[model samples]
Target chain A: MLAAGLLALSAGSSAATDGYAAIDGGTFRSVLPAGPGIEQVDVAPFRLAKTPVTNAQFLAFVQKHPQWRRDRVAGLFADQSYLQSWANPVVPGAGAPADAPVVQVSWFAASAYCESVEARLPTWYEWEYAAAADETRTDARSDPAFRARMLSWYARTADTPAAVGKGPVNAYGVFDLHALVWEWVSDFNALMVSTDSRDQGEDPDLLKFCGAGAITMQDKENYAVLMRIAMLSSLQGAYTTANLGFRCARDGDEP
Target chain B: MRSIRRLLRAMAASCLAVTFSVTAQDLPDDSVYQLQVPLRTQADTASTLDRWRGHPVLVSMFYASCGYVCPLLIRSTQKLDRDLDAAVRRNLRVILVSFDPDHDTPEVLAALSAKHGIDDTRWMLARAEAGDVRKLAAVLGIQYRKLPDGGFNHATIISLLGPDGRVLATTSNPSHPEAEFVAALRATAVASKTPAAP
Candidate 1:
């Protein structure tokens, strides 16, 4: 109860209500290959939000930056379905609660919201790194229990709306990393994988790509994380969906 | 003398205002020009996508150092240019923006332009800020990812834009201009020639 009271007090003062948790960066093996025969990549230290941005916080953002409001935002920056769940341009009353994680937000809108609070969206690597943790262990993808929990959450439909911070905190003190809503990363467009991307040299059209080749998955066994990458790769930046929301990340370890 | 200079400045500002209002009048709400990307062209001049707004344009993204498909990308557009009649060709502009802006500096872009015999009058090779590059690619529906080898894996797509920045059509097969893409180009050319309703 005391912790809850303290959290509310913090929420009233700044954007960091649940607060930001510091994650020590190090070399981590990712499901996606960095290069041929390279499965591990280095990550730098960063602070991440404890929970996803909620409807109430986003409503405040839209009110302050009217240009981001659904009616006023440029079509080039956001699509037709942006903020579709909202009852009005500014209110989240139609089934969306103030405490619920904001959904139906485009990448641009999400980035803008992060900017308003002096932070930015987490990159694909940062998100992947933080999400690999469970409550007790920093990297828990190896544990059967963790994988089972993730699979169960993945099975749940978004029909039952999600309220932010309802899930258990992970080892890094982050909440709702999974089993809630998929997120928007700052480098969302960088995951340019095609259906046959695994066959890199098949396309004769040399002008198509200027680099090594299309990215192929490294750890095929990690289906849960791979699914996230696949969904993110398929979306355009202007697209918004009912089950997509985001959180912010900042450089360094200052709370 | 100072008063006269101030008066000249005022006159120049008014003329600029008039030009902006005229260009802004007909732009569509969803036009890609709504994005304010700071671009640097091959000639090292600062510009934006809308600089070519008054003409029909063939737009694509590429890097100067791209080994394979990028050359074909140029050839495909050149083929389209070759197929067009002289009049339509003159009215059309071709823009190839670089996805690897860090490596594709103005000097490199200029050298590539010179080697390809790209007429600066009709074609522009350009690069933009990294953030702007992402936003531009987003608006154009192009996808790209930088590889660890300092190369990029990207989608090969060429888009056709009307006079006011509306995307008329796009195709992954730039080497072979589809009949529909050609027809859209023709329509855009005709529209460009016609005066505004006002």
Candidate 2:
């Protein structure tokens, strides 16, 4: 009985360390066009969690903030599938390990979790800059081998559940950016590329954007990055999915 | 039996009183007003999003410098007002908050208000802090980004909020008002005017 209780309790509380590593930000070429004259995007220095927040950590959070529990969370903040994988509101079901990265969470829930820790979600530029690194070099986009590895992960079926810290850490000590799951960025909605269909001979929704028209994607060949952008832009704030999780970032310059 | 009936009436009256005095603690868990962020109106007054809590509101996000779509958005809102009966329209208010606070200051908002001939009595042009802007947009489901030309690319949506500050309906069809959306607005307007039953 004691062993069973220990196991159940283990799935609710793990190490409290948020594992934040400071990232040095600079001007970098991004696949998304940096508004006209700006040739490169400039990211400010910030600290990112070395790994995505875990199921155990989130369970503890939900237990503490009952308003965020799946059963009690307001419809304005989350959809029906929010926390659908959990057996109960406070416990992860079978096949869900304590150390596995938490998935099926809405942007609001993720933001609240970050706030509870006095942190925030990483902006798109900051996340992209951090993920550009490999095990050795900081900017590994020119490396064909690095690109191939990232593409292979995308090519594979994402049905397999991911556990945190299993993959090799990058040069900045950040882990599982590409291989684990699609992470939520703070400006997910800001990636609007216009999908209004009324004006187009093609699918009207495809061209239905307001303002200066559809954002011209820069590096079209970078399907990996473009796919992430498409996925992020398509979702609303209250949406959640099986293969989407998030990590937290802080506004600090510490390396 | 008469005493029992009188006691129930008294209990119901107390419930009505409790609802009327909606303290901060009484705000619904799902209320958009729970955001608790400050906003400045074109009148140079500081208020939160829930200031219009006692009335139904049509809320959207826009920037003052937006040349094309914003004008259409304003025209659409005006059209919505025209579609409603005078009685229903009287209880309704329109709020257009700016996503670009850096450019859309109170002075800029006031200028746009004049340029558009916005009826200040029913319509408000407001700006919130940058941090609050994101939270407001998230609640309203409006997405926007600053462009290289100092312009913005955004999705256009207008949401209808009931008196308690919960979203009653939303419409992305700014140029053409949907019949169902207008009906929801009319219903909310009528509902707001009705006295609380005790």
Candidate 3:
């Protein structure tokens, strides 16, 4: 009970300030292949939201942009389950705590929200680079304890996600990147093209893809990140799920 | 002879322009035309995605420099066009939007159109800004990524949109057109002409 009270207090303070953290992005080795013969990806420095957008923030967004409201949104941009957890169109109510991260939002709806704030959804490379850090080290992906903790989170299923900012902050001072929810990246659809089809001379799926080659996983042991890629690739732009949410990123240092 | 051909193309373009302006306001919520993306055609004319709104549109994305599957995409689309009834074919429009907008200028697109022998009246090679291109690809469920070598790894799926810009069908295997997709195209084209028939 004391921990819950402390969390609520921290959440309220952070919600009032809702700032961004500057990430000095450099070349990072990713699990997903960047391109043909490309292993390491160069991500430009950007500002990422310190925490996921919460229910209270999203509710305010819908109130201002009526076109993005659940009842008024175009069918092409959101599915039937968009914001379904909310008590009503304008209220988050009990089932959705205002401090908890907002889920059940389609990629288009998330993109629109970020655009409203003068930001955009982070690209896959940017998201991965930011998430690779831990509380102490810039790149804790090589640490066995860190990998194990992330894998355990993937194994456990929670009925409701805890409030944002309750988890440990990474080296970049970002929170809830792993233990909270899967995020919607801007280029989610571009992640899973099969690169092996290029060498397989008679590959039947050749017509389905064009140009240089397909993508191959560079780091197979990073199953947690690989799972995120698999999940994102399987989803369409208009799809919404209970455990999927997003955060915003800016192009340069001007957070 | 060249002047006559240019005049015919101009006449067709004007007709399409009139049709688009008339129906621009009442687009359905699910219509792909709801996306306000500006396009530049191979003929150097400014256009939008809804330029051929009242006609059945065969839409796909490709880069002009692709040596292998992109060419097959055009050939397959041409083959599909050949198989359609002449009445349905007349009302069908094909727009292949380029993924590499920086390199695919009007001159490059025009050269590609000439190489493919594409009819300017019914076929258009268009390019949009990089951001708009991504949005279009997302709507059509097409996937593409730019390689370091300047070539794009992209999906070769061809989507058939009805008169209202709703995706009626999509076929990934463009080399051998799916029978169901062909039938859907025929039905949509015939149905679109029904309200206008006397």
Candidate 4:
């Protein structure tokens, strides 16, 4: 993401809450990128959930809504493969509580939950920052610090489902960001496409994310920046990972 | 002088207003609007988006191992970078997030970022939690299905997010032209700085 002003901007539809994000002008200027459609997502400072959405919270939503429950709303989530595993209740009971984060949800389902609560998903950047934050830490489980913390957290508890406990939060005061289950974000396809809101009228040839052909490069440390951008982009919207879960964000009293 | 200040502010506001389309009213039932996607922390992750919170961003998605779509996507990204207004480019940061966390190792991601002359400053490759991946795909209106080959058969969609991580607009694949991205950059160029609270 790049740094910009706090002014309101409109790309296409003018229906939701909007705000300006920032970027590191110097860093952004120093490097070159793959072919160009990209969005510099601004991740403003805000409260992030301590842990991944748990089964309990999901159960609560299902219980109250009834419509969102697995039995009630069939075929509303991930591909059948993902659905199948979750199809059988891993947990004995179905009703979930509000304190736990929701699980077994697809991005599609998470998004709907956020919307119903009048909140939105965090951009991957924001989620990552909250989940694993070290001026130097980038990804989770891989980072020694992150991994160590996760191991310790897990060590204290059994593999069985559990609620988050009181613990130190990140620099931003987000709870259980790293040790808990993975949290969902809004910008998953950070590497694959070139997207722009300002240049709606520009020619069509410049967009980068529309599907690039192939990329083969090796050398590691020397290319971390490029790699970072591309890695985020490489993801698709259909992915389903057991570790992944989600949280939501909301604009100040705008609705 | 007052008029000039107003002009500058107006120009900046207009820039944001022109590019930032999301409002509280637009976002409703966020759940089930699209497919159920999953996300995981990438093996090799990049810098934080917090670094770019206040700037316009150009983004793309691709796996390092992709034989075709990934390459084309990088090429397009390069073309857009080359074509962006110098001013917009100065204020812009372009990043790539990978979908394949398992294979997109830090080394693989770095090499992929570099193969196309991408440097760390502006361009990058990061990982996503499966949940985050799904939510992002939905917001951008992108869809994909895993292929038997351990790859994905996903639509190509280009997206722009305001400094605040809000979706500005998108360009679907098979039709992304370079000029569109440049225009997106321009839309965000004049806004006042959304510098992270120091």
DockQ score of each predicted structure, in the order shown: 0.31, 0.28, 0.28, 0.05
Clashing pairs in 2: A195-A205, A195-A208, A196-A204, A196-A208, A197-A204, A197-A205
Looking at model 4 chain A, report the run of 10 residues with the lowest lDDT sum.
Answer: A21-30
**TM-score of every candidate relative to the true structure:** 0.87, 0.82, 0.88, 0.39
> Arrange candidates by lDDT, highest first: which order?
3, 1, 2, 4
lDDT of 3 by residue, A77-190 (tens): 788999999888788889899889999999888888887788889999999999999898878999989999999988889797679888899988899899999999999878
Candidate 4 lDDT over A61-161, as tens digits, reads 44444334443332324434332324343342433333344544666556656655556777654554454443343233245555555546544543444
Model 3 scores a C-alpha lDDT of 0.82
How would the candidate models be sorted by TM-score, starting from the highest?
3, 1, 2, 4
i-RMSD values for every candidate model: 10.7, 9.9, 12.2, 15.7
lDDT tens digits, residues B147-176, model 4?
335575456676776776555666664234
- Please give the lDDT score at residue A42 for candidate 4: 35
Q: What are the runs in model 1 whose C-alpha is more than 4 Å off?
A: A1-19, A194-203, A206-208, A253-255, B1-26, B194-198
- Model 2 chain A: weakest 10-residue lDDT segment is A198-207
Return the DockQ of model 4.
0.05
Candidate 1: docking tier: acceptable
Fnat of candidates, each listed: 0.56, 0.41, 0.53, 0.10
lDDT of each: 0.79, 0.78, 0.82, 0.48
Candidate 3 reference-contact recovery: 0.53
Docking class of 2: acceptable
Candidate 4 or 3, higher TM-score:
3
Local lDDT at A245 for model 2: 95
Candidate 3: segments with Cα more than 4 A from true spot: A1-11, A15-17, A193-205, B1-25, B194-198
Q: How many steric clashes between backbone atoms does each model show? A: 7, 6, 2, 166
